[model samples]
Target: MMTDLVTSQPAMRRLRLSPTLSKYIARQYLSWFCSFFFAIVAIIYLATIVDLLDRLATKDVSLGITLNMAFLKLPYLSQEVMPFTILFAAMATFWRLTRSHELVVARAAGVSVWQFLLPVLASSVVLGALAVCALNPLSSVLLSRYERLEANYVRNQASMLAVSETGLWLRQADESGQSVIHAESIKPGSVALQQVMVFRYAEQDRFVDRIDAREAQLQSGRWLLFDAWLARPGVPSEFHEQLALPTDLTADNIQDSFAPPETISFWNLPGFISLMQAAGFSATPHRLQFHRLLALPMLFAAMVLLAATFSLRPQRRGRVGVVILAGMLTGFLLYFLSNFVFAIGLSGTIPVVLAAWAPAGVSLMLGVAMLLHLEDG
Candidate 1:
């Protein structure tokens, strides 16, 4: 009777102390979480710098430009790498706890596994929010700078504003009229024409004239067309005549005619879409990208949940290696599935918003289910 009473007293003491122990575990987990997070970021940054140096070695870009480009590229890479970093950090934290037998002790103290996971989940939520609100804007700025630097220094080929398998197309306008130009191929600053056609329309919505050029070169705010044929669209079809054409339109002017979708930022996406549509350009892809950005926070949170689900199991089962592998595989599968959905969305097979958010939603559900099963079972 005396021994049984002594054993019961210790059990009562542990039950009373469980909350304090759980809180202590939470603090330790957060400390490890932060340390691992920053370490991973540093390692990724160093690897990126090394790779950038190798690529820039053959180029004549200035050091300042190279450094600027590298900084700009970091935000984009951070977004890509951060989710996985969260996973690895969680794995490391849990593994360390398991190795030290702290987890076992906590479990034995009547502290449920879910009690210990609260801190990790909180940290994940905080990180996901930071990535979306703070890091996203920075990424937008850097990406823009990186693109500009690439266009200025690394791109040797005459930049193409638009291309199709059918042919190249551009919109050019001047004081006289607006023109739609189509050609087989454009060589940098020059328009190379196997078949070239230009439609000239008047401001009054009248048919003005058409020009067919064999070849054209943009020079000094003007276009010089050789072996050109002129026709008045409003006049007789038989009135076509061969001639040389000259117009005030240069490569810079042509470049200004069409804008790339990536140049727009998340904040400006709605306004930009309205502006693009008003200016008569399709804004489908830009709209899609905008929705995807909005979904990113949820995606990041889901990534954390997925990682925790795969790696938070008991270590005594001797399946640590399998758990790590499963975490990696889950991350990869989620990535590919998100991309596939995005592609389908872009192709108009699915709603853009649905495509963007569905993967994150699905993963989150799966993670929650796994957590409930493991914790309760």
Candidate 2:
């Protein structure tokens, strides 16, 4: 009996696939899915662009600048709609599988549901990572360009930037002196003035002295004016004097005179925050934006999970229209809640980090719970 059993036990074999077959299947699936996704995205994108153009046209925006601004805005629009595209694609794919009973056949062939989900999970991860790293950089560049274009053609305003080649000129006034500073440049968080000149006026607009310097830098809380020359009002025509001039303004004061942080990119948030603090300005919004950027991937994952929970239920006996409506309602509610939390976060009622992450965290937990209940329990 033992010898018979040993002879009956054949060697286990592994299944193999031909490279050509594998490539063909991959190409087919990619072609089908990409076609479907792009079609939907194109329709939505075009509608949005048309509406924006119509609104701007009424405001006297030139056609060329309007087109440029709209194209520059495409990256942000794509980012905003990508999660919805993922949801629709997943729903359509599963619906097709169910309608044709392909899912049934796969299950009959011993393919687990988890096994079927592996490809989707992998794709979602790759897309999420790309949205953060590659897409964000492109969006930042386009956004900067769009702002400049808008200022030039659409809006009659200019955004002041910090650096300039002609040097930094600022008006300063106090009880002791009224001074206008002309320096080669002003560093963000440090006072390093080059080719400095200070024109001083005495009480009742009397000329006091003019001080010129080769270089000046901020140390501690004062500006150490250096390599200086002083010309007093009563000096002889052939003679000029040299003297050291001191200032109480520091690097922090300079930075406080600029615009807010909403215009900066995610990549520059950390450095900007440090500079803002060094310049004695509140960096709360910048810190919040940093946390919000960090939470985007989790938020996107939660969106997918929420979509699956509502749309992936067994529909053999249920109304398909009702299911679709339910999915739409769920998506809308999630969107509303996320925006509400973001508004609260921006209002400073809660801590910046907590406010930025709370919506994503809650949505993820709710999605996971619903999925586990439906799929496992």
Best by lDDT: 1
In angstroms, give how far residue 163 of model 2 lies from its true place.
8.3
Regions more than 4 Å wrong, model 2: 1-61, 108-112, 161-263, 316-318
Tens-digit lDDT track of model 1 for 39-149: 766776778667777777899867776767777777777777776776677777777777788878877887666667766766677777777667776787778777767
The local distance difference test score of each candidate is 0.69, 0.63
- State model 2's lDDT: 0.63
Cα deviation at 327, candidate 1, in Å, is 1.4
- Those runs of model 1 whose alpha carbons end farther than 4 Å from true positions after fitting are 1-30, 105-111, 156-264
TM-score of 2: 0.65
For model 2, residues 203-322, the per-residue Cα lDDT tens digits are 787768777887666666445676677777678432223334455555555555444443466777687777655534456767886787677777766766676675555585668777
TM-score of every candidate relative to the true structure: 0.65, 0.65
The C-alpha local distance difference test score for the whole of candidate 1 amounts to 0.69
What number of clashing residue pairs does each candidate have, in the order they appear? Answer: 1, 0
